[model samples]
Target: MTDATALVQHLNSDFSAGHDAVPARVNGTASPAIEQALAHPDLAEPIAAALAYAVVRARGAVRVAELGTCPADRVRPLRRAVERIATERAKAEAVCGPLRRPAQRASHRLGRSLKQTPARAVLPAAHRQTLVTACAELGLHADAFSVPNQRNGAWAQSRGLFGSVPSEAVRELAARDDTEFVAALLHDARMAEDERLGHHLIVERWNRLSATALAWGPYAIANAERRAVSRPLHARRDVLDALEDAYEDLAVLTCRAGEAKYRAFRLTCQVRELTVTGKRASVAAAAHRRAHELLQVSHPEELAEIAEAVRAHQVDCPFRADGCPDCQRVVLKGLSGQCQEAPGSRPEPTSPPQPTDASGPGVTYASFGAEERYAVLNDIPGGARVVVSDAAIGEDSALCGYGWAAEDGTTGHGDSMASTSGEAEIIGVCAAALTALTTHANDEFLVLCDSRQAVDAVQEVEEHGDVTRAQEAVLFPEAGELLTRLLPYAHRITVRWLKGHIGHDLNEAAEALAGLALRQARGRIAERTAHRARARTTSRIATQYLPRRSMPHAA
Candidate 1:
């Protein structure tokens, strides 16, 4: 049998069993037993086995369609197969978790192989003729030649990394006609060549354009579902060498991206210091030590370039380049200076403590034994204050709350009925700092917190300027979003460490608020859980006791 016929036969045979088990529907409705079994892995074996067969059928169709040797009419059956598989996977996600990734992988393999195929096999007649004529004029063989295979492959790889073509790029392509699509792609190809850039550099520029026709848009040649190519891995030596090259490229790029991000964040801190305080920011000896440890760099010289850039910006004073040349000279001279302080020796509170909100009726704050004096440096300028914040989680990992107290007797706290302690900790600190920053935008603020993880998360945001990095590190996701919102006001913010329950006044007060918040949150959670249980009991009783026709309608 031919490729299409063989694919149809495989799909038919594989899915022949349980033909009536799931009705063909796009509504994503399914039987409760099947749904429950799919979601719960202990009950997944039966459904997983059934899905394995469907996966095989769908993947095979995609593969044969991609090979380019198949007839054009075969596209119809292949499209239908893809749709059916997608529908099935959509309905199964209640149990299957994520099946689309496997389907996407199959498509990627197809797109990557298309580049090595002849243009006549991959492109339609008009476009193929255009390419053929152009090739003849350029003194290249029409029938046997590939179309810029290296850049095309690189674009394909970038698409695979990004997962899909961006929507804006797709919308731009939608405005263009099919012939223009090919013309625009060729135009970009010529531009890439004229620049004399390597394949990866050209591809990176194309990817960054976001509006370029060569972008993997719906009608673009580099479309992940259409024309593309990859080298065959059957040649062991070539494949191995290619793998090594790719690994090296990826590793170098990852390192550079991280290093650049770190340097950018540090420079931002320095700029904030100069702009806000009219003097250099004091660096904590330990904070720098921690940063170096995380970066895994032995020499400080790796950081010197970005540090110099920050100093240059301060000196050049682009915002006031001509008017304050003398001011710039003084600032540049001071940029080389640092006032290092020993760890945990932050400035002491200048203002007296305000009384705690002890009369709140719902929950009582937990008091840590007796208040004791902790040594704090008295070096901070008159008005600057540290906000000591902390998060508390209940035993069942359900209830969470965070609280903060500024050295000037300004205190605030918030609570949530759900989340882990780590999540709660970061949220508490970030949420507290966000409120404080909004209230005091012009004042310098330091966030003192007890959770090392939470402090590190804030540090990550400071060093990388990516709050979502915390969520990517599997810290709290909500905390990441909150931190992202706080970025605009970051110039005035600093986060530092505080030892928990050590009898420092603001730290103790913040702890009390955190504990109280946790208590209140747990009570709220308990009420909700009880309410849900009661509702479920009522539902079961009504279902079992009442006649089907007489059962009360659900609101």
Candidate 2:
């Protein structure tokens, strides 16, 4: 806020489209706060941008046509007006070397931000034109990464899609993954509204930052390459932190977008409120309850659309009561049509199996099996996954070469590479509770896991056990041969075990993030990932749960 020091002065006053807006009624007035912020320098622009993004989003394409009373036209006022701040910052830096631009340049930067650099625009409804321009600009500037043939609809729904939230649809403000939000908001809205919102939803919820954004946003490849080159854990974490921060404003923009959708479409209604933890099961129940309430509405255009969408995604037209909870979102949507029943997969026959390990001396491994519904966060597969279809294999980045699993699994042999790390596929992963030493040298290394087996070859203590163990390339195998070589030039190195999803917070977050990144990379945007984050509510009220069925668990 180079212009206003403390707060935004006249947020709603900037637009003169002649609409009746009772700002005092909808968004509470903060004149005193605005006046106070006017005196501060850093707060105005971001706030203004956030406000502007909210407006442009409210005004969707087909602006007044589809918007009707929605006033989707307002979505562009500020986006059309704001200056290209990111680019001006770049040019200013070219001359000033790290110092911010002169006040005049910044004013021009914020005055018409979208016009100058359309790629940085926050309005999802304007992504098509902006993305084409962005592609052209990147081609001229960074030919290596320019998106040439990419089309719009990554934001707006394409043909045959009912609808999805625009890239600007905000779920959480101050979210860690904001880059994808920006990418969708500024570039993909032009996507035919038919493609629906699934792709953007998945990515926006999961991957806010990407290697592409880092490489292209006001930085050079040298900086992007450094992301791969850094070894110190702190350095890597800092880089991630900076990328997450780069698009914090995107969340604010999306918040406005979600509000806009809720207002204009009126697609959802609350029939009842339920008290529950922040989990998929809880959220799904909430969605179901909302859907049921909307069904009773006299005039529910949005609810009808959702009903059709739900039927199209469900495992069966009406979900079976006794079935696996782990179901695919798309399949569930397909099955959720005009049925009036509890949602779940169709029941299948199960054959009895032998049991032994259950009575073993002790549990040797973490035992949470992979559950498809709760595939992420849980160390082991959840029961939900048991009912999932194998055909729904997601094009996740972890399945690609970018995730830690892929990196760990890489192996080199006689001019060939292979994936062999059993560690990557281990279920119920837990950490070893021990740390491995790191080195200074940035050379890549390998893990020869077979040597650990050699340690078990001889358990009894012997005088020459240590010497004999070192001779063969088996017991303490890799360590014995490479110990001396690693001591001299290494700066930082650490041997870490990825325990099966044994409830470690960081590992869970990473796995969740990786799944999200995969969806985004695969270009599926509407897959919303519901995580256990605290909700944003001005008031905290609790609810009591009542059973819908009389003998809910009776045989």
Candidate 3:
């Protein structure tokens, strides 16, 4: 039979006779993956057919054969059965408007199935018709209410009078079509937990019907206008002048302060803003073009002329004159502070070393080398003092240490920690900061840390009240907590970044302490690991054979 004729014959058959139809999951809750599959345009026909079957079963109007039914009982007529299913689907399409793939159809039967699913409480046929009519006038399809799993509670609650809606409220809502009915229904429900639901119910239905039409209408015109004005290359001076005059004309037409006037004002402001941005962009582009031209000129004389022109136009040269080979030959002649293009080509100037009172009596760090650069730090009369910290990570363990040098002399501390190198650095800093705050109450604090990231994390906590930059520096949160608690005690707290492994005495002392801590942490980790291995071996040996005392009695 032809497809059309088969469809008609199926509609004629009695769909309400059978009682074995598969009911789809109530409320159309298809999994995200299945919904994505159904949304494919190629699968729409099969999906639609499935939904029609589901709808018919839900309506108590028809039933199809159960899965794995005997051939003898199900072998009546294959052609007639196909036609019946098709006709029922056609009826569903007429009521639901159109079933788009990806959108879960309330009638989808392939996913979850529940036995004896509860039906929505019935409204009078007349009231239902009235609601559908009101919805159509507001540009919504009636099928939106019936699609997917039935939301019976919402309907029942909205209607208010159990099992039926009052004639008076229905009349009042129907008379006002612009959002009043749905708003009243939502207010009655008091569903403040998710405010978007009411908006979604109304907006999705309208959007489905209007999206395609609007794509080529006002949307297209607005996009074209925005592109012309927003791009530096596309915006012409003449065109912008014309727009200014046109804006004035529009303002004259909408002189009153209402929606139209407000819209015109906003449009005028956007155009003016874009014009300023476009002019700046044009200037930058011209500068780039001139730089490209200058870069191509190999001769020093020609390049000099180009550079002069660039300066006359108040544009800075893109290349550094001291560093660029071409510019260096012409522009940087006989300048005392000129940079050498290549390293070691010229001797760079250095400042004279400052005088120090290292001869004053003070305690010395054993870790410092005998070289003069590693001079003993004298006890300086000041409100603040310095502390240096370091951390080292090994293959099996990590550790940290800190050393403080104040007016009294040098004092050091070290400890094993279960963390990476970065965390160790931060923890070391935290230890030093804590010691300084507690020991020197009336003095300012200066902490020097080796790890740059750790130093930044500490500063971040001091400034922002949080550590956001360094993720590897795990001890930052603890450091932040300690700093926060110690803020009241210290006169002033400062964290500084210092290069590691230098000849600085305090830093060298901290390095030695950190190495000692790393060795201790590694030994502890090894001992624990060996203990666990031995325990496991002993347990296995003991369990290999059952005890004679615990054996079951012989039968």
Candidate 4:
């Protein structure tokens, strides 16, 4: 059957059940108002259609709640359905004018009944302002024209009241379309009035408007504007002048609205970018290391072939023209400078490997059932007995790094582009575990980690019974890879959580190593940035001052 036919049948079934009957009687019967509205031949189809849409929408909302999380792809279609119904309602209203009293009463009763349904349950008052702001932006109000006019008119009247009484800076601010700035100004004015503070006092303590207070400005402005209308003209003028003067000073303190948060977000993106660049550099360094190892043993003819392969390998280094650090290191080892071409390739490289077991050396299998065999593996390898891992992020540089220390005096540290300290911690633990497992595959390992989250994640993975199922249960890429690699050695490896920073020698050593790694990464990034700047400056100077040769006449 067609969707419309099915919807109508569903609506009929609901109505026949007396689910929304007036007075909610036990016997099944339609409400008098509903019956009257449906009795009219002209209104019957539209009423049926509207009721059907409401039922379907309500059912969909229930299904969404049951599913716990809605897919992003489904959101657009649901929004379109809402929009279509709203458009149809608008068209009907335009043709019929305001809904008739009978139809209106029926709608009101239907709305009251729907409020009892799970789909129409009330949201918290804390989110009311947010919902209203979103509704304003989406133009979803019943009286869209009047609501916008009321908001704009309130601000315009307040601005006009100030006249030429305020400074040029204040007037400039008033003219801009920054709602947050205007809201903050109005909020400050209201606060000053409450404290009975003068305009000069407000200007003197302009910085007292904390970020937390600024956050509330958008929600407070509507009430401030409404209250302003009830005050005398003289009082309103005074508040506006105070708002203007305070803003004049506030503008000096902060050049933009939410400047602190914006700067922080921008800095985070920069750090993430640098971290990504550093990761690429690390990969290039590894490839160069491999080439050097091959060069030492290969025949003279193989040297040229190896160099050719090295030149063909791609690297994403910003300082390629000046010479990538990795390529420079290779050049010092007597390789031809043409090897630099590898780092200078124009095409994009494949994505760097994620922190996973597969990225490390392959695991060697040994029978875990025999204790003697495990002891032989440990005795022969002479690997560390205990390994402690820690992660740290630079306060000034914003670079993330991880370090691990072993009882056998083996130590390792590396930098990552992790956006958060927590992620870095997990990465550090994984790196430490992967190293230990690969170096002594048959040996028992006690991996000490400070991060509770990483330990819990490992525990959760271990409890899942099936290795494949456990791997699938983990949602994070790094954590999943770590689990996949570590689970294979679960019989011999143990991950334990330890408290951090109470002078635990191994943990402290790991922390120091992580900090050292962060500092090193920071220095490398700064050097790379300076190299890029110098290159750009040189190129610009050449373009501007270097004389262009005249082309031959086209005879």
Candidate 5:
């Protein structure tokens, strides 16, 4: 059997036998290897705690498995129990100072006899204080546990004193084949305690260097190069080879960062294409996962620029034809060629634009069929028409707009000038619901909106059944007004949250309409401002140089 397995069996037997002195005896008397481990002051408590915790966890796992729980589900309760015990121990230590070393106390008392001692007699003054402090903190009376020989009942009942070990450390220890599993168990204990035992400094320094080298950024290459040139040589050939492998990974990452970015962009495009074409959810999700993996190592700003270029290409060249110059430019140069400015004079791109209107010529909106609607509104009565609403804010202007599209092909959009996107979203949902009420007053309407805040606000009003209170609590007067108007129709309207920018057909259409409305509103504002400017200039010139007849001869 593995050392860990044997240790578990030994602990189970000792605990089952109700031996008050097992905590002390198990460390040294169980096996020669364990005895040698306990000889080190740093390893004693950690080793004992690790063994006890492992036994408790193994027992719990076996119990849970017999109840037919899955592996993932089985781990949660054991983890929670370990965490609880650790928290309690920390609190107790904070109040009464740390628990006395049980192994040391037992050794001094036994004096080579190694006979079983009553657990109550074994408790040092500090341990008693800890138990009392723990009980007081938990609001339990201390007098209930004055029994003569209850073998450290509190510690045993709490399943030992160790904290949880991270899965990464556990997996790494398990992967090593040269050492006994007991050594792995010792390593896990030290890791959990976060104690700096021998060789810890070397491991910590190497980890820091590896993290810096692997972190993808401007300094990654330099850090990798420094480590490759200056890393300390180890006596073991295997350790040296491991360092070499890490250096190679860093080298590969640094050398291929640009290529990775390009591949990520292509993958993103593929995912978007698949989503917009009404492909299977699983297929689109898989593509998205692949794209996300590549995105992790890429620079955020670079990815944003590429995404913007792709979006612009989708907007300007609706066909997205392979041969189109703009499409080719986006693919080859990673920049949109739509601007007339020379390459040197072109302004650096800003933040990515919001999702554009999908109603544009080349963009296709995926259908949200009956199956999708049913999935979202399984509780709501059937045969209700679906309306998806979205809002957009101008990038450079304060202009905002709301758009909504019904599955019945009815669509509406309007600008809410000088309002924030949050207010615009509520206004959009209100407008969509009101429009639906006008057309199909008797029909139930399910409004799928992207803004959770808006949905929550509406639900709040419904729950409280007070429009005046909602008006007082709302941030924007316009939103309050729109919501008040839709309040009476609340029974017919159901507002549900839908994630924005995914390939939902009606939602995309609404998003596109909202964006289009904002752009048009911005254009109109610009036109009106230019007209006033021109008129003012004309009047100024007339007064200065057009021979203004001395203010009409003072008439």
Candidate 6:
């Protein structure tokens, strides 16, 4: 008869004996127990026997389906954990390889000179994307790298990576549930690309595979499921490369942001010197050095990227600009500086909301763009406008007991503006005498410290009323002694401490006067220039409250 009759006959024969002697398989081979004993190897015989006895396992189809949903749901996280790692890997690989033709060409030339190497797993989303990418370009398989771990009974992760559903998985899931196809198709259109893939394929795969594993008992399922859920070795490596590339944009952007901020901060501190010296060379040098440090930290994984890309001959620039040798392109270089053309000849195209790496340190799309980053740097060192008045500089002895009021000389001395000079009266002199000039200057007046250490030494000298080795040569000026006598009159004198650049009209006036006096002291007798200085300082008063970079554009 047919195989069915034979299987029937065997089961009937065994059942005829007793339930305890149930046939392990429907087929008339060895009894399940005998086979389990003879197979010697563990579990193989049992799983084989259990499935073979499924005829005995036959149950209402409805019941089986109901049970299916439970186990399958349990295994969902494990599968998802695997796929998430894959998507990021792919993005990183795309960036590192041939984003531009010239880069591609260079990669190709370099590849020829080098031996093939293995690829490593990379994530464009992580800190080491560049390194991960370079390994990918060199035929190295970066994505193959994964260290999986379980969390909770239901969830699992690989590489601290999330689980994702790819497009193929979605198709598989949809095909299995054709009854829901129309609804899913409609939903797919409204979903994001990754989310669409996730709902159909990723969720479906997880539901199916995990349920399958759980049905066989979670223990057995877990043991065998490793292979079923694993990323294909080649695909894994490819994904890792993509992941690394994802962060390339970020890596470059972060370095750029950091370097920009560092330079901006440095500039704000030394604007006076920088403007006067016209030495922008140090800015570039510092930028380059800072960029390098950032590369070391943010792109540790990308150290060999250039060399690897080169040796693999992966570089291909469509612009044909790659062919222009450095010396050959001197005329061209004048027009385009730096690489004759970008590593790729991508014509600069204006695109809405231009895409940028979401990876850099201070690179926020909303508030932390290049401009804002510079502002933060500028804030690092404070800038202020102040009215500094020294009594000796006034016109008392015409030489010694003099005070220079900012803009005291705006009109005469021919309309050439200069600081006002005045002789201090005895009362003013009494307040200044026996005083620690530096000490009183700082304590009585808040100095926004151009340097943190100027007055302490000066202040300490007179606190003990003792002159030091340095002070022995010059006696404390009478003006300082007078200040010591009448410091209590500070409430009367009204020495106001103003923040730098704030719109305090007096501060602006004082600063303007100071500038005018300095110019005058240098023997410049230009009246128009002095008047203009006051206007400039006044104009900037409004900008004092805005961040440094914004100062130029503040209302």
TM-score of each: 0.29, 0.19, 0.27, 0.27, 0.29, 0.18
Task: Give lDDT: candidate 2, residue 137.
Answer: 40
Q: Least accurate stretch of 10 residues (summed lDDT) in model 6?
A: 409-418
The clash count of every prediction, one per candidate, is: 7, 103, 6, 0, 1, 85
lDDT by residue for model 2 (339-385), tens: 23312335457885421122343333334353221222222222111
Residue 293 local lDDT, model 1 = 36
Candidate 5: 10-residue stretch with minimal lDDT? 111-120
Q: Candidate 1: worst 10 consecutive residues by lDDT?
A: 111-120
The runs of at least 3 residues in candidate 6 whose Cα sits more than 4 Å from the true structure, single-residue gaps closed, are 1-308, 311-444, 448-499, 526-555
lDDT of 3 by residue, 1-555 (tens): 865444333322322211112111122454443344434443333334344434322221111121112253453454344455556556544543344321222222111111000000111233235435544554544632332222322342353313343455344443544345334332322223222222312222222222122111222222223333344433344443433333322222111112222223233333223321343334323332332333334234433443453344323445544323233222323221322232114555789544333345433444335532333344323545566677665431122333333223334455534245566677777777777666655667677777777777676666665444444355324444555565454337677666566666556656765655444332322435544543443343234322412322111
lDDT of 5 by residue, 1-555 (tens): 977456544543443321222333432344555454334433323333333333333333332232232465666766665555445334433432222333223222221111111111222343345445544544544632232122222222233222333356544533444224333323323234222211211222222222222232212222222232233223223433433343333333322222222223333333223322342344323333333334424335444544455566566665555424223323324332422322223466899644322224332223336336312433544767777888886532234667777666567777663234565787888888988888875889888888777777776776666665554234435677788888888888877777676666677668876766655554332435544543443344335322522221110
Give all candidate RMSDs, comma-separated. Answer: 27.8, 26.8, 32.0, 33.4, 33.5, 34.4
For candidate 2, the TM-score is 0.19
lDDT of each: 0.44, 0.27, 0.39, 0.43, 0.45, 0.30
Candidate 4, residue 157: lDDT: 30
Candidate 1 TM-score, true structure as reference: 0.29
Decide which is better by lDDT, 4 or 6.
Answer: 4
Report how far residue 448 has shifted in candidate 3, in Å: 1.2
| Candidate 6 residue 277 C-alpha distance from true site, Å | 38
lDDT by residue for model 4 (1-555), tens:
965454445544443332243112112355554454333444433443343334334333432322223465766666565455445445544544343333422322221111111111122231234334433544434221111212222332342322335445544543544444444554543443222111221221222333323333322222232233345444565444433333333322222223232233333333223321443334323332333333334334434444443354324545556433233333323333323322223555799642222213332223223212112122322333567788886431224668876655556677654434665676787788778767665666667777777666666666674434533223235445666776766666566666576555567667876776665554423435544543443344334323432211111
Stretches of model 5 off by over 4 angstroms after superposition: 1-375, 395-398, 417-419, 468-473, 524-555
**Model 2, position 329: C-alpha lDDT score:** 34
How far off is residue 406 in model 6, in Å? 11
